[model samples]
Target chain A: MDAKVSTKPHEMLAATLSQEMAAVNALIRTRMASEHAPRIPEVTAHLVEAGGKRLRPMLTLAAARLCGYQGEDHVKLAATVEFIHTATLLHDDVVDESGQRRGRPTANLLWDNKSSVLVGDYLFARSFQLMVETGSLRVLDILANAAATIAEGEVLQMTAASDLRTDESVYLQVVRGKTAALFSAATEVGGVIAGVPEAQVRALFEYGDALGIAFQIADDLLDYQGDAKATGKNVGDDFRERKLTLPVIKAVAQATDEERAFWVRTIEKGKQAEGDLEQALALMEKYGTLAATRADAHAWAEKARTALELLPNHEIRTMLSDLADYVVARLS
Target chain B: MDAKVSTKPHEMLAATLSQEMAAVNALIRTRMASEHAPRIPEVTAHLVEAGGKRLRPMLTLAAARLCGYQGEDHVKLAATVEFIHTATLLHDDVVDESGQRRGRPTANLLWDNKSSVLVGDYLFARSFQLMVETGSLRVLDILANAAATIAEGEVLQMTAASDLRTDESVYLQVVRGKTAALFSAATEVGGVIAGVPEAQVRALFEYGDALGIAFQIADDLLDYQGDAKATGKNVGDDFRERKLTLPVIKAVAQATDEERAFWVRTIEKGKQAEGDLEQALALMEKYGTLAATRADAHAWAEKARTALELLPNHEIRTMLSDLADYVVARLS
Candidate 1:
């Protein structure tokens, strides 16, 4: 992975993000400590200390540094954003009833669903407290809006699950809500807190949104064909759950009458038998849906790179652009 | 009820709460509207329009007003606190798999559990946004602490569920988190935002905390003997669930060897069957557990009344004292 990003074009970008991410991680650890309840520390540490890439907080830190912020509040803001992201994940695993996340047993799986829900709530409260310390109403506004958008997105995804009629438009809305809203807000609030120009703020939001969308699209694409060991998720899990992901949706759009009946039974109604996985894989193959999904991810990555044109030519800007590309390059 | 309030001091307290609560209801409806998402309005209206009593927010308003606050932010603060309370209720229903709230179908039951969780999250985000607009870090501190306390209380409750060994300390910690933290924070922030003296703010917090503890204990007591029509909850519901409520805890503490064995079999081993409710009721009566629980509630109510000494006497203060009395009067 380091070798891939160490090429002349990507190395500088990766280096900047790596430095900023270290600062974000330190801030996360500092804010997650609680004086009142031992369980608060234990539960939050279980998730925060799990060693996933601090992607969301790094977005905030990078956006703030890129916008020429010199203050320390950005560090706190970045941590706040990360806490919210982690809190959502803790709750999401319980809601999805998944057993694993990032190759480890989910907090819910290890502690119980109740702990996941309550501890998630604790992190959310902690996040709000961290943001409030910044004392910027605009920062709070952007983050609170992001939080609501994230929730709305999750709700949309839940409603869309198992519904075969779920189209690209709804899927896009769900992805934007669940994934992109926070990414955009994470970066946007960094700019807002730093009192950046409104146009630059817009650019930052656009950059983050496009990057997050691409990242999620890549994740969905990988779900179909990526190595299970690398991704930390079982292959065909989405298919088994009958999730109407992009690949499945694209294939369904191009299915014949007989194929449509097969999907209606297997995906929509969830009446799959032993041989259904093979049939599903064959259908995805015939329509080249996975390839199409990868192409869509690349398209979004390119759009993210295009948004960076509005930023001044700085090392951070260059790295952000490379990061966008790196998000999709994993597929290639 | 109106006639009774005119004739009885306890009834007068409820009437005062009712009037104060109306203002809270109006504010909640006004704040919940979002111009961007029609779905937010649709989902929020389902719960906001469900006719809750608005007790928590009223506590904030009454606490502030009684403490000589002459500011307008208390209204927003009251509304924000209520939104947080409502959001938790929405999520809790999903977590507990509960079907009913306030004698009506829950949002999770009426819509979907996903909607309940996500919409609840939206409301929570919105609440934080509202608090930030108040520009008081003290208010934020009070509320943020409350949120964590609430979540911690919930996790404790979940851990204690079905474990008959859950003692009074664990039960009190759970009750404080689940119920008293918000009640205290609502009042504490009310005073803090109003720029009340620090001493008065502490007193208000004590008042609310004691009142909340008393309120919860009263409700638990009522669950064993409340009128089905008035409480809108089925009698012996907690018994059926084998909840380690105060009555059960006290009863177990006073149980004979044979009675202890029976409780261990039914509550700990989960061997509840038909006629277990009557047997449990008999045990509670024999041990005077219900009376002991009522005594505890009365003591808390007295403590709440004592906290009001810091505030100047007013009609609202008098009403608050009466409210404290009324909370315990329900046990009779």
Candidate 2:
């Protein structure tokens, strides 16, 4: 939980992506600022300045550079990816009624739901404009597909929440739609716009897919066991919201009748009280669901590493592999 | 308010667009029906099946065909536009906290804010995917810009809702962003994708723009003067919301000290009760604001007709001209 270890992975990625990240930041700032509507800049700057990890756009820039893209369009595309990611986060916070995000008040909390919804929409439009500026219909196709997948994932999560019957397959699909779809699209489109061979493009997509999946699973696992200070989120926050994440889904699958009764009461019926968090954690521990989820994350990280083999061995590719490992390394 | 007059203008455009509209409907039904998320279909079907005029997407299809397009991509694009419109309406109702839309319970009323937000997002993603299928970056540009404009309009409306200082220029900007932008883009892209000449493309955009402006002004005028049963919306709804629509904005500008105080108490201070609606209408009539709004709509309709002069004479063009007249004729 020390700052030293916590900052290492992001710092390493920052070192690798310094120039591209700067460009992406500049583009985001420029595009998000609207002169006609002062409200836009106000709402967007709050979240944009809050300082996210910028992982999705980094994947885009890294993938494009690794694929030998020599053009400037990658910068625009990277910004587009970031805008889409930010827009989704804004709307997600509103949907979840989340107050805090990344150690700051969410846009919805800071402003209002109206601003969050409209500004999120503005970012979506700006992202589309950025993609069109690339003049690559294929890029639009990939990113638009990613957008749909992300929305579908969100809807799936909404419907699956508090539903005990949701299993690993459904959980995986939701995770892929919500998290990995954008990651895969970001990397895949980089290779795509560079006109990389189909096989290698597919490989880049697979790499991103595995990495994103691992990243989300790791975060879900951390909800049970992570130090709250390191994650900047409350432990069992998902549990409080009755979210049937991977760990809970797995745990529910193995629950006894008594345990099932507890879940139905706490999650479905929303009867949580003072001891519910501890009780949920105890149940997860008893079932070894946290460990199982961590195992899944490690397996995905390995699969991501394997996917990189299809790419030419380069510094970026190696770093991407390390990043994949780093994503799940916290559980250790 | 009679069916004879109400349906005349839309009838021709509707018939011309019937086949494409059916395809758009099918696309919406299929995409919105998710296997993993039953709520997606449930909420979406509520709005999609609601009896909207489908005017926006019809403009898209008509623009394409009038330009002599032989390809089927326009159908997908039309569906994309409709989906975006529907998605916005779903979210808008939530933000506005409205109880009804199209004479039925709003999606948020039937489901909840969470479902409305998530499903609206699903439709947005579906829209992007549909547009990408058209394989035209130009089309993406037009629609993306429209999306941003729409969001900005919504945000502008949100902040400017109770502020009496919001003037004619600001009101027009809001209308342009909220309504005309999409209308123009819907029609503009139709011609662009069909490879129409630049002059004609501009003409189509102008035609749609003027028509949208006319349509919005007519709607605003009707809110003060039209029959509630015929419009399927409450009379003086804008007045109740303190929204700075054209009539209100203009009336505010020309108000005496006494009238201004009335507005300040009722609108800015939210002190109005049920009886205030009649008094507000009386003030609007005394100052001729209602007539002024109708004149604006008539002027825009004329401009819309004028824009069509750029296009070669054809049956579709004639129908479009009549449609412009029909949009404003409702105010009478």
Candidate 3:
């Protein structure tokens, strides 16, 4: 294989950890089953089999392997991470009243909001059960705290997503809760289960956190400039929905009176016209806010790579470093 | 002093465990607060202060005290139980689109479904954090299973509520999931945290399980017969919603072809008219299904009292025994 032949870091991680990934898949399948409520497996299988990149679980696997973990508990923890991610997706669809997820009809839309709510709840419980099976109280504590942060972030986002006063700081808090908390927990638990030093665990957490922040920033930016078909989201979807992402917040911060009126009419008041998305893009361009947002994403990705310096230098570590770069590489 | 003049068993337990319950209340207030998202506390305070009987947490406290527990972890666990219950109610209101709970406007109605769903999630996460603080894997395992059971039961009820084929055993499973799972977990964890013997823990589980079943059956019975002012629910609300409770299930089982058609149209098709509730009640009465359902609730209450015989004779135990009877007392 030539070095110039590029492959995605996550794909490489998945290939390298195929056996353990298989085990995680098996565990998810077995645990997601409800002997009485068959609807659980139906809803879960729809999302689980929707071919998500399984990036979060793979992060756990890579972190554990990088730390030279030889135990089976990493597989359980990986499944737990995936389950938590899936559960959040299910609930997010309901909360957002979303019609599409991962390029398919959302569970909430396909079934009813009730199934989505209840089945999402079942997945959360299943995730809890999977973590308990690891028999590591430390892992439980990390995940529990992550869950609280995730939920708190979601509530914050619901209240602040459209508020004109929501600045970059509030946006970061929401991103940390809705996205990075689980990522950090996933990696942190992997290292803790491997019985690594507290320093290495902390490093793993930082790596995951910075990586997750980068990932979300890139995603929010992509909503404006990326291919709708590739991203499974339409351009201006966030603006149409009145979501205040970092790019928009940055632009709004520098807005003049007329610009502020535009934001107030389209975002705060949700009164959009045919050219609102185009006007929003023009405002962002005028302020170079998208470029600024992309820079922030690159900075976080670099921070993620920097966090890996304290960990053992291994092949998995190389992949994780590349994974951080890969997240921001989408912008290019 | 005036047992006949009417202090409820829960009220008695509340009075006896007043100091501890107050501590649990304080802990609930402290934990339910979100530093970042003020909306969380706003929604939580609305429900937490809505004066739910706090029956679930009371069960945990009573069980712990009855087992002579001297530690403060039970207070934490009791708060955990209440948080879980409150979270479930928030989600239930969203799932059911309920407007009223405990005779007050529901959080889902007061806020939006999004707020209720997210805040409910925050509470679940908060509950998970509280349980992890206990540092006992067994308690975590019990609560995890109970949460899964509760979620599964909700899904099962969603699928099976209108299906006439839903039999007694299925109803029992749903009851165990929606109501008994938490009750049993609440009591069982209390015993587990108290470092009580396995036999005592098992007895506590049985007591809570039977009590929950009787409580649910009696509540279902009351939906048709209890006073609206007392039960906070209109008579025939279940029939209007086309829920197939024990009384309706029994009547459906014994219905003639014409009656089966009536159920198929009213319950399954949900084309209920004004007289449908009356007709359904007449059928239940004609077959004595109401009487049989009352008998079943009484039997479960008796079983709850019987389970207490295996435990030590404490004042809390007597209240628990009376508590079981009080759950079914509404039938009289």
Considering every candidate listed, which one attains the maximal DockQ?
3
How high is each candidate's TM-score? 0.83, 0.94, 0.96
How well is each residue in B1-332 modelled by candidate 1, as lDDT tens digits? 33432745434544665655666677777777754344566778887788675777777877777767776778788889889998899878877888877768888787776667677887898788788778777787788888878877776677576687778887888889878999899888877877778899899999999999999999989999999988877888887787889999998888889999988988887788889889999999998889899999999999999999898788878878887888898788
Model 2 chain B TM at 0.94
| Every candidate's lDDT | 0.82, 0.87, 0.93
- Candidate 1, residues A177-210, lDDT tens digits: the string is 8789988998898888878788889999999899
lDDT of 3 by residue, A1-332 (tens): 44453488888888889899999999999999988788899999999999988998998998899999999999999999999999899999999988888878999888899999999999999999999999999999999999999999999999999999999999999999989999999999989989999999999999999999999999999999999888878898899999999989999999999999999999999999999999999999999999999999999999999999999989899999999999999899
Note the chain A TM-score of all models in turn.
Answer: 0.92, 0.94, 0.96
lDDT of 2 by residue, A184-273 (tens): 999998898888999999999999999999999998888878899898777888888888898888878989999999999998888999
What interface Cα RMSD is found for model 1?
Answer: 2.8
In terms of lDDT, the poorest run of 10 residues in model 1 chain B is B1-10
i-RMS for every candidate: 2.8, 1.0, 0.6
Model 3: DockQ vs. true structure: 0.89
Candidate 1, superposed: residue stretches over 4 Å from native: A1-46, A68-71, A161-168, A223-240, A245-296, A309-313, B1-46, B64-72, B110-112, B161-169, B223-242, B247-292
Which tens-of-lDDT digit does each residue in B24-132 have in candidate 2? Answer: 7888788777888888899988888986888888998889988899998888888888889999998899888889898799988998888898889889988998888
Stretches > 4 Å off in candidate 3? A1-6, B1-6
Please tell me which model should have the higher lDDT, number 2 or number 3. 3
Q: Compute the lDDT of residue A298 as modeled in candidate 1.
A: 97
Question: Alpha-carbon error at A39 in model 3, in Å?
Answer: 1.3
